[model samples]
Structure formats: C-alpha cells, structure tokens
Target: MPERSLILRPLPPFRLDLTVWALRRRPENRIDRWDGRTYCRTLVIAGHPVWIAVTEERAPGAPRLRVTMRAPVLPAQAEERVRQTLERLLGLRVDLRPFYRQLGGDPRLGPLIVRFKGLKPPRFPDLFETLVNAIACQQITLTQGIHLLNRLAQAFGRRVKDHPEAPPAFPKPEDLAGRDPEALRALGFSRQKAQAILNLAEEVVSGAVDLEAWEDLEDAEAIARLRALRGIGRWSAEYALLRGMGRLHIFPGDDVGARNHLQRWLGRRRPLDYAGVQRALAPWRPYAGLVYFHLLLKKLEEQGFLQKTTC
Candidate 1:
C-alpha cells in the first residue's frame, strides 16, 4: 500500500483536537485518536479500511492540515476518499464567518464564540452512523454510551490492521444487520435499544429505510422522518439532524445537558424547558447549534477534559 498526503486549508485558527474531542465525547473512544499534535482514525473507505492521520502545523496565513492516508489504492483514489471523509468529519468546508459576525459583540454568546474560536462542529461520516450513535446514547450517560459503542465496534467492525490490537472503524449497516440482538444486549445495550438498533440496520440494509435521502428534504420534514424510526424521539432526531445532516439550525431543545449548559450560561434562576430553550435561542436562528458546540467545549474545558493539543 502506498501512503499519500493531502493538504487542507481551513479558514483560520483551527484546532483539530477540539472538534475531535467533541465528536469522540470520551477518552475511551478507540476509533477517534488524537494525541496532542495529530488526529488519526480508521475508516472503511469503499469497503476497504484506511487509516488517516491529520495534523496542522503552526504556520502564518491560513491554517494548513496535512492528511496522510494509508490505503491500498493509487494516490488519486486514496486522496479523493480521504478528502471527502475529512471534509465531512472535520467540517473543513463549513464557513463560520457568518456565524461569527452574527453573534459579534453580544454579551453572553460573544464571549463563548471567541473562547472556542477555532472549533468546528463535527459530524459522523454518514446518517446511519449518526443514527446508531444517537440510539446508543439515548437516556444514558455519554460515558456509558461510549463504552457500549466501543465494545460494539470491537465486536462488529473490521480492524484497521490485521493485528488483534488495531482499532476498529465504526460499523456499517451490513455489519450490524446480521448481528444477533442478544449480542448487542450483552454489550450493555438495553433490550429495547438492541431491538431498535437491529431493526434499524435491517431496514437500512433491506432498502426499506433511506436515512441519507433525508438530506434532500426540508429541515422540518427531515427531522420528522428521523423521529419516525423506532426508539428515536425528539432529542434523538434533533441530534441526528445536527450531527448527521450537519443542519446547524437545530439546538435539540430536549437535551438536558445542553439545556443545563444554556441555563447556567445565561444565569437563569430556573431550568429551561423545551419552549423556553426555543425562545431563548430564537435570536440565533439558524446558528443555534453552533452555540451548542461552543457550550460543549466550554463544559469540557471547565471539567478538565480538554488536553493541550501541542506536542
């Protein structure tokens, strides 16, 4: 296999680790690897596993990211897959200038936006991966959810290397489609969650459900379609909308953690409910989800989960 490198230029002041941490959610996540200077992950690209290492050197002008892709294909094919994957996973193409200008000089959100200046909202590679993630984390602590996902990945997904110790890529629908429900349950998934996951995978594999097609629909219609799946509620649907479809307008009003963060940030005497969150975020309009990411980074920094990314 030949290793090829591609350079990406993000807007400016970009931090890959910040976005990686938000997506990985826990230090136990094996698929998303970030050790100070570079971030690496194994993704199944065109049915073959590929390992990509991304690092941005401290340079003047715009930030530059070097993507080294290890794969069996020629340089052209490997670079294309790596570029597309990086575009989606690291949000390389998203322009945050509008978001920055919109909240400029605002008291509460202004400081937050400035604090996490280099942060870019990340997404799962595809809608199925996003849905499965949302399903696994529903009504549970993120740490526990990540642990379950780690076990599931190790059991079902293919390893980046032939070695037993290699990290596995996130599983595909076909990978989980044939999995036994009891196996998932044994991995700490509840009976209902296991059934939901199995059913969702089967539906996707059988062509009965088209989660990716939702991207072509309006936000309201797409969210409705997402919620139509079994075990997917408002929170899960909104989460899928933002993290899966990259719809930045949605803030997931029912998210207790986000609500708590928003309330505390605003110094509200009472907790925010669904309507309250909606009202509070109305001013941000289509950029409220960006605020969610900012708050998440703030929480992570305050709790000491943010590691210095300089080696």
Candidate 2:
C-alpha cells in the first residue's frame, strides 16, 4: 500500500520539535522517536499497525505539519483517527496565550517559560497506558522505567511488519489482558507491578472498567475513583490526572524528581515534601502542571537531550 498524507494546522507558536521532546522526555524512549527533524511513532489504528511520520513545514507562529502514514491496509477514517490522536498527543489545538499572559513580570518562572515557549503538556492516548507508566516508574529512575516500558512494547505491542526499523506501538489492553504476570516479570517488572498491569489490562478488556469514562468526572472524583484501584495511590492518581486526563492544574506533588525541580528552581534551602511543594506552587495555581512540563524540558535541555529554541 502507498503512504497516505495529510496537512494539519496547529495553533500558532507550536514547534513540533519542542513538543515532541516534551512528549518523549529522553532520547532513549523507543515509543516516541525524534531524529532531529521528523517525529515518528508506530500506532495501532483500526486493528492494523501504522507507522506515522510528522514533519514541520513552517516555523512556530505560522505552524504547519505534514503527516504521513504507512500501513498494510489503510482503514476507513484512518486519517481522522490519526489526526485526533496527534492533536491530543501533541496538544496541537491548545492555546497557551492565557498561560503566557499569566506569567508576565514573574521573576522566578518567567524566564523558564519564555525559554520553552512552544512546549505543550503531552498526554498518553488513554488511562491504561498512563497507569502502566506510573506503575513502571514508581520509585525508580526515569531511564530505567522507560527501558522496562520499551521491553513491554517490543514484546506485546503491535508491530508494522513492513517497517522493522520503526518501534512497535504501545500495547493495547487486549494485548496484555491474557498474559501471565511471569511474562511481564521477565521484562524487568517487579512482581507487584506486573500483577498491577495485568489486572488493569484485564479490567479494561472485560468491560469491568471503562478507563475513558473518567474523563467526564471532576478531578477530585476521578482521583478518588482511581485510588480505589488496587495499585494506584496519591502520586499515581495525580500523575494520571495530569498526564492522562490533561488536567493542567493537577501537579503530582509526590513526584520526587518534580519536587526536587521545583525546590531547586525556587532556591529553597530545605528539601520539599508534598506539603512544601503545594505551598510553594500555590501562587501558580491552575498552571502548576504547565510549570512542571517546562521544568522537565529545562532538565532535558541541561542533560543534552534537547535544545532551547524561539517560538
């Protein structure tokens, strides 16, 4: 089959490179691949594996993207599915103007926000993946966590047979629902984590849970419901709210790395606990998650994985 192409116009001040780096976080993330120019990812669409490549045709403030997809059989509505998924994943339609205006004259976070103007808060395609990520990353370094996820994807995720070089898509619930925990354990998941992933997958597959339904609930209600699940806790629940539901006001205060980033960026002498994180970020209410994303980009830039550019 031939590759199908489409044109997309994201809101201005959108830089695909910056947005991708924010979504990918590290160069080692196999699931989201960025090689200087184009951003490529394998996605499962309409029961077929598709390889997608997106390139920016114009700079920020007049942004345009050329999206190309190659699949064994192009499904009906494939273009629309790809468009909506990319729009949500890349935050193509989100306007950051109000956020920028809110940061005016702020001595602490003004420069940081200005430095990474086009970065958007990216999300997992669904709650199942978000929960899996939170479980995989609990109490571990991000690098190790991403390695475990890559292994999971390589093992159970759908692959495009035609493009062996492209990484496999993140596993869907059906892909993992019937697997034994031992299988996940072999891929570097702890016993508890393995079981948690399997349990969530099974719940999704059996229709016992509709993870997407939480999108309609308020933040507190959603968090409460999420915490009722076996493996989810405060941090995981909050992380899901921000990353899965795109609730920009909910910052995962219990995230040690993010807390450290906030403390250091604020020049606090003492290390911040959850309470301290909230108190310090109270002034930036409703946009603290945006701050979290900006801080993450700053860290990635410092580590040489990404570079700052004008929007």
Instruction: Find the candidate with the highest TM-score and give its number.
Output: 2
Error of 1 at 237 (Å): 0.6
The lDDT values for all models are 0.83, 0.88
- lDDT tens readout by residue for model 1, 1-311: 56778798876657787888787776777778777777888788778777778898778778889988775544446678778888899898888888888886778888888878888889999999888888898898887888888888888986655434336888899999978899998899999999999999999999999887887789888878888899999999899889988889889899888999999988999989999999999878879999889889999898777874421
Mind giving the per-residue lDDT tens digits that candidate 2 earns over 1-311?
65899999988778888889888876779898888888899888888989999999975458899999998888888899999999988988888888888884578788987788778788888889899999999999988999999999999999987778878999999999989999999999999999999999999999998898988899889999899887899999999999888989888999999899888888899999998998898888879899899989888888877853211
Off by over 4 Å in 2: 59-61, 307-311
lDDT of 2 at 60: 43
Give the candidate number with the greatest lDDT. Answer: 2
Q: List TM-score per model, in order.
A: 0.94, 0.97
Per-residue error (Å), model 2, residue 76: 1.2
Would you list the clashing residue pairs of candidate 1? none
